[model samples]
Target: MKSIFRLLFFVIGLSLVNAQEIATTDATTPDGVGFKSKNEFYIFGDAVVIGNNILSKDDKKAFNVLQVNNDDTKMRYVDIDRDPTTFSSSQAALKLPSDFKKIVYAGLYWSATYAYEKGSRKQQKGNYVYKGSGARSKIVNQIKFSLPNQEYQDITGEVIYDGLGSPTHLINSPYVCYADVTKLLKEAEVKSGAYTVANIKATQGYLSGGSAGGWMMYVVYQSPTDNPKYISTYHGFALVNKEEPLDITFENFKSVEKGDVKTSVVVSVLEGDSDLRGDEFAIIKQRDGSFQSLSNGARFQQNFFNSSITNNSIKNRDRLPNSENTFGFDIAKLDIPNYNNTIINNSTSETTLRLKTEADRFYLYFTAFQTEIEQTYFDDIIQDNNPNASVTAYVSPEIVRAQPESDPSYNTKEKRKAYKYTKRSLNSKAFKYLKNKKSAAIAGIEGGYYVISGVFSESLRADKWTTKLIENGLDANAFINPKNNWNYIYLLRSDTAEEAFELTEELKTNYRYRDTWVLKANLD
Candidate 1:
């Protein structure tokens, strides 16, 4: 099944390279999907709104469509960056926790409603008339990005969905694209700072549906103090409405059986009204498989997809202009564990998500789910507290020494007996012994002595250290010592204690591994 998926992705990649568009049958379905799982936390932010306003419940009845003649309602560029050279640029701040040690992944997504400006807009018989035809552009996937204290650089991404030529989007065509920016963020001097995105293509006139354009950045980071989690990101394009509610199913992840399970979801949508109600987000309950509506204090259960960017119940006001209503862009993170614990408990390894609206229509482009899972540990060996203690302490000197000086010529039989006695004495010292086990049988660890190079309390740090060792031409492996729950990274393994001891001394000669030590397992 894994090979089949890989082949499918390969074919999809080839097609994308040729056509540069993710083909979809209609405007209300996903053309492609991408997923990833890791032990990390994710944060996202977006910008590029021309106007901002506080939409009241009463205002929902006044506006039949989002495109109005007012200056605040018009679709234009939100040039908050104040860079005179760029055409359409906006800035958004990414404020990650200081404790987030490393960035695991970063993705940049941009979307827009395009192709409505080529038509003539006029009034006929007290009704607005639009004669424009939907069109696609070749440069829709090209964009410019700027990091803090840096200049703009060109970037091109894979087009996830392009709806310009689709039959459903005749006047208000929309498209979404994404780029993997993990390498760029990792190379940056600082991960959290103001980010600017420019050259996003979108209609800037009064089209049929409300004109909208923006760019978003999703970042996943690792912290040593954070719990082990299964983080999965999925991307697609679809429309959810009253007639056809979208249901997305998530699987292939395990959850912890004990303790408070932490799970959260992040979603990005377009064309959702801030004043409108009845747009609901629901997830199937693990207890009885019932769909429970999800909402926070700022978002009502009936209006879950209102235009805003939020983390939990807190509205993120760290962007330029900090618009109260983002016109139509919505990026939010909902805490599932805080909403209800009984629905998504320890038994939940799979669940389905449903999104529907009674009076509003919107497009869903991206969604991500993260949940706490059982932490995995290496089962290579049991940890001994006093690893440096003398092995001869357990064996009496008389038993290990030659039988007697009187036994001339050092009888080989007596020597063999003493060696056997010493081995038996060591076995009785609270140590487990095994023999002739294959390397695969013990978590890819053979029965041998290990030369440990580093020890860490966190698995993520241990993994990082092991990677650095491998990059430096050393075959490194890591395992958790169950006794103390500490991670131990080993550089070499040997079949004999003397060989392992000699290797440790040789490694200690290097300044990097000056504190290297040896661990011996009683494997016959």
Candidate 2:
């Protein structure tokens, strides 16, 4: 048997772009991954706003699809351009770069083109509101393409239209169509970007005179071979844990410090255009559940992705593109070379990359890869942990002593809550919830004011911190805040803030309780 990691990473928004229909001779899709296409249906257009193209030139690097809804039931809207240079047609054609190579990936995007919502439109409904027969397909589904000699040819590949479960669209719903044009594209590849042009046109799509929208298409493709090192298969997973403004960790991600394999983090704009991905960031969570800003230093890498796109000049990854909508780059700083040693002197070993984009409007995908070679070796050792274990990141006395020591006293504004599990026993109900949340081993509980410490979204990371603290000569334990459902590194609860402050200093100065923070709760 072989290790298989199947991910639908390409699903950003707008019905996940029908990634399941992608033909791959290599790996199997894991269960509970793909979705039914018909259920994601809509008429040729819904929520028609004004736009000439599906995306502005700035949005070219990323797929621009829109969805509406609250925490539940994401409703999507797209503008499909009907062809022949009509008034403000949203139609777009992908022009290959002159030095194009094999197209490893492509997607045909169709959005709600309902041109007109005359009279009045309904606002609310049951379960979820959907298009009725009145909103059925206004145009015929006959699809055409712009190829070399022939002006328009019928596309032969299977067209998987998006969400058609509704009674009306069951007949003909707007959808994302996937046509394998590898042969056609390869034949035209030699033309040096000029010989080939592909555009989608639902030319025969007919609409009622009363209808508001009908016609055209939008398509986006990624031809990685244009660069010398192509993406054979981007092996990684998407972190959609809770959607926008998320803190995520992929356990399967492994690498050595200074390793050849680099981790890339790309956040697609489902709803933003002012800045690049990773442009504005909130530092890792603090005791009061606030974040520090990295806005000034947030970067954009010019030459990292496609140097040609930047006119051979390297663009800063954190800076917005001139086009303004599309941006992605590798976050070398966030890579965890050694899991355990991620903490040196109680400071963050792993980088936290969260965007403070206007209300955090984005989706994230992460990929890891080394060069195409037999093997790659790393000679640098930024950190090394357990002696008996492999030379990776581990917590040791040297690392602890190397950390700076400082403790702040009596600040109430931040509402910092720090807790350390005191050996003092608790009631059955509280203990049960504690167990469900998880219990960490402590050196021993003591009666003293305690300091605020670390916090983690994952139990494994929290546990490692607990162990490291205990080893470095202190009673440390993992506790769960059943309220927020987060794991934490805390100290025994203290009777007074003064005593707690004293202990905080002791731990910082003596035991290297470096990044410790306070934990809070209402006793009454």
Candidate 3:
């Protein structure tokens, strides 16, 4: 079986192109095909049977043809093997397409059929054989045919008929499948039209079983009109769990973390122009509980998929005397991965490959910074009220950690070197969502705080102090950059110089850690 694994793999790959039509035997079809009800009027296709074969006495590999719906109200059967009538299309009681230039695989499942008896005197009677219309043809109806092979040629092509015995014409015998019908159907051109930036357009409707995911966003428009359906539009580019289009904004922006849910987490970026058939890629679920393509917008750019976040909590230390509090961010960070370069034709526009953000630098009109004061300090008041109360506190903090910065200086010629070091330090495996949204200049980055520790008598306390600072409300994740020996801890959600100073003052007043300093905002 392992030797034939490649063959099986190819078959499975071909199956995906037609996911909607092919149902597993365990499942009932949407049209109620598996029901026992009589009025359902089941339809079936023709079968492929081997008749007069020289190799085997009884060919077991034969199949039937597809039967028509509402065409004939009768049923019949024909032995694929040794049945001269089966191979003769001239007197084929039923008619196939005249220009029937091709037959890929016979659609066995969708075809209709009836039953017949075997090895009885009545079987030899005309009632045993299936007749298309009239006569004593016993109508043991047969439907559906399995594909023969991968070869493809016009049904009108010439072939040498076997001359071992009497002359015979293998007319409709699928014994030779010279036409690659699978490829034709998959790459079939169903629709062709374009629209403006936000215009809604509809091509042909897609397969309903969530199989035709690539076409879902375009097909499932609310009104199906040319109007820009903002809210009703099913955008497949945001978090995958909830179906909603993220209004493009650029205020209060931080950084996009990888694995922050939109669809399947991007596992790996494959080499070369995007291969639509790549096994690594999956579906991008849309707002309407549907899915669409998440292929990257530009070439040589990273494509992103849905990402996951393990720990949303990042912290910084308290600098005030007799205090050990931690701070965190209001917004949670999810994970996302970089995409491999996608492929598109000359007519298609490039894709935008940045993460969603809300800031002035990343998004011109929008701001990503979100801020609010801690009106009721729960930890502060909780301990004062109930000295020994075993209570769980909501670990909400003021500063959320963004993807760590390597070098705040973005202009130096050495910046490229800095990025190389930075990419490696972040482990280059975690998710970042803000990266993609920043490219369009419509997202924002929020403000957060990091922690710095003062000199302590014990080495463990120095580390422990920083951890405790994060526990209260700080983005004090240790960003040990190799170049600067200075331990720069950042904080989230500070808007101005005064606000940063106030935070620093509070830190100094609360925890007695040594020299705490603030880094100036680099946003221009």
Candidate 4:
């Protein structure tokens, strides 16, 4: 009787251990947590499946029919590079705008559903059961990563959540890990390229639900041609199904005070089916505090997690194979402000998001949100008047030119001289529009030409430089360019290009202003 009681207690304890689900938690901030920048941010990643031709072209849209772990599916390595040393690998491309100046922060994330193999299956009461004991591994957090045209390097990351360590992770046997790759990317100057991740350690055979694995890189970059934005990235492991829905609330950031506000969210999920229906992604509306389903041309409100990487209604075809359905992996960017039923606006600062499914069960590992914010400008500096000072060089010049001459050689000589001066000026400096031509609203100061001294990403730095110039008796002021959110410090503004060009040339003679250039304020 004592032995029986002991056995009962043992069973109870084991069940309790298996009942605890992995909890979602925040990753350590590589650049001080929450939202790292008020600049442009984006994400790029790919699914790491072990096999090719898993689904036929005919099964692409066969809703509720095909699955990753279907009986007829054969599991194999998805090695597009044909590297003989790696066990399994996959590649995804990353692309950023040419104007992206610097990377503020970068986080690498990789996840997989491990240990559901054919040998672990057993029949109990006419139902197949998976033990999944092989899922636990001490080296689960180690993986091989390669940048474009580079050799693979081994990297070990922090385990965000491992099902083997969770009390309730046994149901699906999953794990997610992360590493701060900001320094690596900065040193390597990785702007855009194909990234390959290998040895993810996921089972290829079959699992009770479905098999899935993937890696993602979330990056925050600074750009002189993008609006000031609040960007935040969150990482963890949680399940969303009919019985348990997930809600993630975001705060510590505010929207722009006025004008049009744009907000977006990016999500990375695993085990979502391309065919299964009933998964829903939603956000709490600020107007009514009610959940509103998010939908686009590529995603449906009732089936948001349909195993595809998308930006709004458009699908991304930047990766190798670029499969129509990633088996079960999903990464998407949803522009909330552009959605027809969106309730987010200028008044929104905090928000709550929810994910649930009635027929499909999937794991949510990563979520990121970004929104436009008011531009930060430098404070105006006061200048003291000095009677002994020389007159400013920016004064409009009087026109002085010889009248047209009858002699053909005289005209040719004048034309040649003018062309030489124009060529020399253009070759010595570069210029760009202060505002985008497509923008409807005027940007920067109300001048046709600006003699710019410097451009800065941070307003504080621009302010500091402007202060020094004012102290030195230079009539310098800074203005925010609405088109790109960059602070431009200018020494002079003129209505005519000739006046601006003359002032720029005069300033170029000074060692301190050797790089001074002209900015055309109006392209229209």
Per-candidate TM-scores read 0.65, 0.31, 0.16, 0.60
lDDT of 2 by residue, 1-524 (tens): 12223321221111012223322123212211122211110001111000112222222232322221111212121223234532222222234443222332332222222322212223465442333334434332334444334344555434333323534333222233334444454455232221112232221122221111111212222221101111112211122211244432222112333324322232221222222223343334323444444321223321121111111123222221222122111222222222233211122223333443333232222222211111111101111111221221111111111111232222223443343333212343422332232112222334333354665657777788788878877677655545334465667676655445456555654334543433323321
Residue-wise C-alpha lDDT for candidate 4, range 413-449, written one tens digit per residue: 3442221122234333222222222212335458477
- What 10-residue stretch in candidate 3 is worst by lDDT? 1-10
User: Which ranges in model 2 have alpha carbons more than 4 Å from their true place?
Assistant: 1-52, 55-134, 138-143, 147-150, 156-175, 189-524
Candidate 2 has an lDDT of 0.29
- lDDT for 35 in candidate 1 is 29
By summed lDDT, which 10 consecutive residues of candidate 4 come out lowest?
1-10
lDDT of candidate 1 over 142-224, digit per residue (tens): 98888777889899998877786677665567788888877898899976778888777776645665666667887765543
Instruction: Give me the runs in candidate 4 sitting further than 4 Å from their true place.
Output: 1-74, 116-136, 165-167, 337-342, 376-524
- In the range 103-174, model 3's lDDT, one tens digit per residue, is 222110100111111111113454343222212122112211122222222222111111112122111011
In order of lDDT, best first, we have 1, 4, 2, 3
TM-score: model 2 vs. ground truth: 0.31
Ranking by TM-score: 1, 4, 2, 3
Per-model lDDT: 0.58, 0.29, 0.19, 0.57
